[model samples]
Target: MKNTIAERILDFLKGFPPFDSLTHEQLLIISKQVKVSYFEKDSVVFGQQEALHDCFYVVKDGAIGIYRDHTLVDQCDEGDIFGLRAIIRKDQYLLNAIATEESIVYGIPAKLIEEVLNTNIKANRFIIASFATNTRNPYSDEDKGTLFANETVLQPNASSFTEVQSASFSKNPITCIPNTTIQDASLIMSSSKVGSIIIAEDNKPLGIITDKDLRNKIATGKHQITEHVEAIMSTPVITFPDTITVAEAQIAMLKHEISHLCITKDGTIHSELVGILSEHDIIVIHGNNPSVLIKEVKRASSAEQLKQIREKAQGLLQNYIEQHIPITFISNIISAINDAITKRCITLSIEELKQEPPTSFAWLAIGSQGRKEQLLLTDQDNALVYENVTDDTNTKSYFLKLSEAVNHKLSIVGFELCPAKMMASNPKWCLSVSEWKSQFKTWITHPDTDKIMLCTIFFDYDHVYGNHDLVDEMSDSIFDAIDSYEIFLNFLGKNALTNPPPLSFFRNFLVEDSGDHKDQFDIKARAMMPLVDAARLLILSHEIKDINNTIARYNKLSELEPQNSDLYNSCIQAFRILLRFRTQHGIKNNTSGRYIDIDSLSKSDRLKLKGCFKPIKDIQELVRVRFMLSQMM
Candidate 1:
């Protein structure tokens, strides 16, 4: 064991629990003796009724689920301590500790804990309290204060979380008399601060007029305001009962493409109008509307404001998936918000630079940002592509300065700079079109692991700002390079299959066996990315470009390979469901939805997850045959 790694692990542990109360020398001594262990999915660290080891474990990475009688009682993520209960009680383990995914953990000797307790009063009190809080009173602690806390521990009915939460409603709706003119309807709507007006007949909703109707019909001179409310109103309006949830309302509006839905006593025109549900009301609750969020992004001048807006967008994403809004639409809206954020970053960077960019350059968002499926806030993957500058030795320095500014501003706007320094500020990543072409040629021809990693990152580039022509030219060069080096696709195929779908005999999910996340599956690597990588490889083979989004690629594949349209369509559907599952898990845990504890999932959710695996297995089979990877496997 590296002393540095052991010291680092001790440093983390000393900040928390019983370890915190121990003397520095004592803690460091225990840390040095700690046994570092790793686990694959489903592997048991310690089973119920089994004698405890000399050491109790602390999760260093991933999760460890504690199960009693096959029911998960608690889950310990990063820095969470487990396995001490058995030692404390002087009995065999009452619950099983299983790795929730491939994870790293440190086993600190229980003897050291005893030594600290015997010598230090403070350490003893802390140890007793940790045991009381975590083991004896598990429910009253972590469960009560955290949002979505119910999801962390295993339970029944896990999948039945509200599909659409009840959105708060406006009790009073704007109304107009049947005889009211279109002009008057407009005035009432404006004064009432509403986007729609309900045309009521005998106190019952007869029709509705929205801003769109006035703009599309009256403003275009298709109709005059002098026309009565009935002339312009859309009769037999869509209505729902007051109990309609934000999810349902969003779906209704998107399905109809209308701005308003009447809320009546019985959800129909025959019933009395009780309230109004307008698109604005839904947008307020929906949280993720790109149009509304972009407006917020435009007005945001500070990092704090952008953070709040970004948080709201996360909720919006949750609602979008729950409502079954097509993934394509979801990706588009998210992409718009992401672009708006990047644009704001650019503006902020320029201000901080105290000067404008020296030359025209396109800001390219690579990887998930480029694919537009980035619902989660992750490290920024961006590059800069400037117009070729000739005869000026000073041009390189100017562009470099500009990239530094842009990268810094983007970091402030919530995109953490890539740790590998793949951002535009890295001169190697920020290249002119001709330079990028040569770089692509080198990577394609070489196709080593390092080059492949770069190819993966750069392949997903989507222009966030500046010249579209330059981006198109770069893409054209990429395809040309691929066409000339056919073996490069095989290299990609091998890389795609590197992490095979995590399924075992009888099609059960293969989770990590030991370490911190024992018995948990990595949904991202084992499921989602296989599909994503496969889609990328197949699309590249078809010589298709500019389609980075996974779902879009599948949609395009459906059109291109009519012979395999069924499988392609199935892939799209499966991808959508899996993406949603991963996003929900991520949101609930406040972490990337890569590692998933199988015990926490309800039977139905497990089945639903299993259903997604079918298509994955089928698709991988397709990839294997198409690429002749059977022998390679």
Candidate 2:
């Protein structure tokens, strides 16, 4: 009897690891015996001290949280495996595995994993590496040599350190000429057992056709198989020099979102094509550097490819956090990757429109991204400002369409759509420079509760892609409006004080009273936001521009006000610690990092967090005194 579900399981398992190391026959056999389980949100699969189940679990959908003493220790999302530690140890579970969201999971029998561990060295090493990374007691000498007694555990290479290695490519690349019939090219590809075939003239690459092109064009009947390959092939192919490193190659593929890159002698279209590099080749090289990811984003041809790369970046981020890399460094690198992806999406959208913009436009990243504190994938908050035009209808239409495309792509790449529809794709947010100026004026002058909220989100705008002059003009306009309505800063100050300090008089955390995160501390709203609000208000009052980052703003403030330098420095330190803490929590629980489980934190961590609150309290008082917000409050 045929089992369709088993086949699907095999397909999914093949894409992820320890399973990826297994043979097809082994996977098929294991998949057939796999048990599928469903779990509701907050439902526990196993509790700490319970006897280990007969099998380990792999997440098929949604997420599972591994908790120690009711505190989340790790989160297992799609394709992630958990519970193996307990199985390997043959002991009571040390952590509780609970569904963080409604989920489907596959349970692979312990016997199968044991067999794989004994038979496959790579599978064993991967499991060991995963345990080393995930386990809280990884450095415990008793567990180190015990798991892999005979086999040595090879740690995964640091991504940044792997960038300089030379890249490997397919030397005997399959090729055709411009005049080759699509059918002939297809036959050649089939005969050669290749997914792509390059079209060249004088041994210089002209275009390329891949399996995607065939599926999208020939299979869809958009183009006939009898047509010349040139009619369907993707032209002006991305070419890289043979001297490119593994990191460079990987980045190239990601940047263009293309699966294949043409390797040429001189790294130019004018040079002779020598070889071909595919995404598969880069994956095989195992270089997961940020530079490589940025390149991948640049070469990404579709949103889906960018999405895969972004997911890979999450893993990289987790590794960095675990390694205790500087939080500022991590933030800067991730922000650069995010900015690059946004820019590439914009570039791709323009190509899709097949026309130049009628006027200069600037894409503004607002909120966390604007402040350059985005360390994890979060909702996109952006707006667009274009040059004023006499007949604005056509220009607006063009930009709206462009924004729609860019926003959709950004969403696909892991940035969630703004729940409030604060994206540029929204017509209200996408406006000409003049309209944007007028809108800012209204919000500043009016300064109502809603308007102040909007001001907090929008005022920290950073130019992501497009005309800097336009963004500069927009900034200038904001200062001009604030100058006219000086009292607006008081309203901003009042809003900043709304959250108050995160700690009570007894130094207890202020947890949520109600909602999904009732018992959890709202880190963003209570801790991070107060600092963010203070920075924006203070910076704006000084009429500073081009300094959207919270840390940078505080640093600038410290420099400008030597008398208040201590408070500003304290604010900076608090903001940095909180930012890192939030990022680690997000990574641990696969969450937004807005809510923190107080039970999960160690005493030292709690003390550190508590210490940060004093700065928040001091900052609020300073704002009150500076802006005279007592009456407003």
Candidate 3:
């Protein structure tokens, strides 16, 4: 009597996104409406330039290979949807969708989207984002040869964005004993179809034999094929840790003039080899270069023009999100773009003055920007520090005018003024190096509710431009102040615990009890800020100055306190999830991603978000207990 087939489909769809975000009732409607189609191996579901299907597909079983020409573009397994983008556009399929194996696909009616998008803005945004991220084809011939073929929807994909990403290396690296014959190594390489093989003894890498080694040594008759691998192997193999990044790997390759690198456990020759990274891996990941956007920002003469570029960078962000790029890597890419824009704004402001700086100074991005975790365009939180001058009044006046100019330009380029007047132009924040140092000391030595809050904001400052020494001096002064007033860290720790973690997203208990945006969750204040405050407090306690980003700070904390490594690591994961959620909401609503409507989240999203809450509660408790804040209260 039950609609078991539809119920089964509903169960499958509930585990995936977009649908997972829908209510059970809405999803059941969609499930019952879905038309099931089966295809044999290598069967075409839709062909390039073919008329659009009335419905888009979800793979019920097996795999779908989406091809543009003969090149495979994407692989869609179970839970992956295809043909939706074309249906959304009401256009012909631009790429061929073929069943790579015998598959059953569920085709959901296009009207389901109409029903969903009409009432659900969250679903609407997902559909829009998918359309924006998936396609690259021109709408018309006139659009070609411009900056992008489809300038309207084109955003940089994750592969093209700047790389601070961990290299996805060959984890099961091909290895041979040092005494193995060169011919035997070559045969092993041929069977595995890998370009390189490591020469190892007792799991420790001794050397590497790349294809070039064979080409240069054996082919040139410098070494015989029957000779031992060690005889011709490139000894002293360049070894790096498993945590090597794409940029680091690329630099290492160029620095040592070697293509293959052995990833070891301890980043030392004596450590056990864990993986291998080669130039090809880097090349495959390289796409829309973040450096290209940075260069564009530098060339812009006006803030208005820079604003256009910033809009384009959001496309990159969307693409990165759609591609499921690592959140930390995405943050790094966006922050780099933001920093470049700010630097350009300063340059333009300086040009407007028609006079050089009166003294050595450093412009800094504080708070979120300082941490380089500001993925969304939000209020500017910044400051300026100049070298101390005898004629402080005139010097302050000059810098005030400069800061105002810079802030105005920054505003035009999309970083709006902070409502709290926490910006360089505020004069309160624009101070000489000595004055800034004194301010830091005051905040530390004589801490209070207000000063502690200010400390949270200002302590995360990162130099954006101008003289570097001024920023370094300020940092050294902060450590000095903290050392002099050791209890200051406990104050900071207590402040970090003020915002308790959410109970979970299942109920309204943790959301705003009364607000204009009533019942909305303040993800920033409640979820993200707690983690940010904890990371900053913990790192500051350790006297580590270099790590400003919350993720990086937690990473450092993990290294410093291996005893509490799991807690710190969990915090890092939770922070990343929260930050990504905030950015996604910001993208959807076109506002600062600080607030979230608790009701709109999909079941999958709520559960994913709920999983992150436990870590927050644990970290906050750790902060409360470690600082022994009961006495302070």
Please name the candidate that would achieve the greatest TM-score relative to the true structure. Answer: 1
Regions of model 3 farther than 4 Å from truth: 1-289, 504-509
Q: What local distance difference test score does each model get?
A: 0.75, 0.82, 0.81
Tell me the deviation in Å of residue 91 in model 3: 29
Q: lDDT tens string, model 2, 1-633? A: 888999999999998877888899989999999999999999999997687789999999998976666644456778889887667655556578999899999999988887998888877656655432332222335334322212233243322212323557898889999989999999999999998999999999999999878987999999999899999999899998887665466445534656788999999988998999875565444435554466567768888878887887787778667756667667777787789889999999999999999999999899889988998888999999999999899999999999999999999888999999999999999999999889999999987889999989998888999889988888899999989988888888898899989987777899998998899999999999999999989998899999999999999999999999999999999998999999999988898888988998899999889888989999999999888888776
Candidate 3 on 412-499: residue-level lDDT in tens? 8788899999999998999999999999999999999999999999989888899998899999999999999899989898888888
**Model 3's TM-score against the true structure:** 0.57
- Please report the candidate that would top lDDT against the real structure: 2
lDDT of 1 by residue, 410-440 (tens): 6766678889898888989878877888999
For model 3, where is the 10-residue window of minimal lDDT? 142-151
Q: Which candidate, 1 or 2, would have the higher lDDT against the true structure?
A: 2
Give stretches of model 2 more than 4 Å off: 1-286
* lDDT rank order: 2, 3, 1
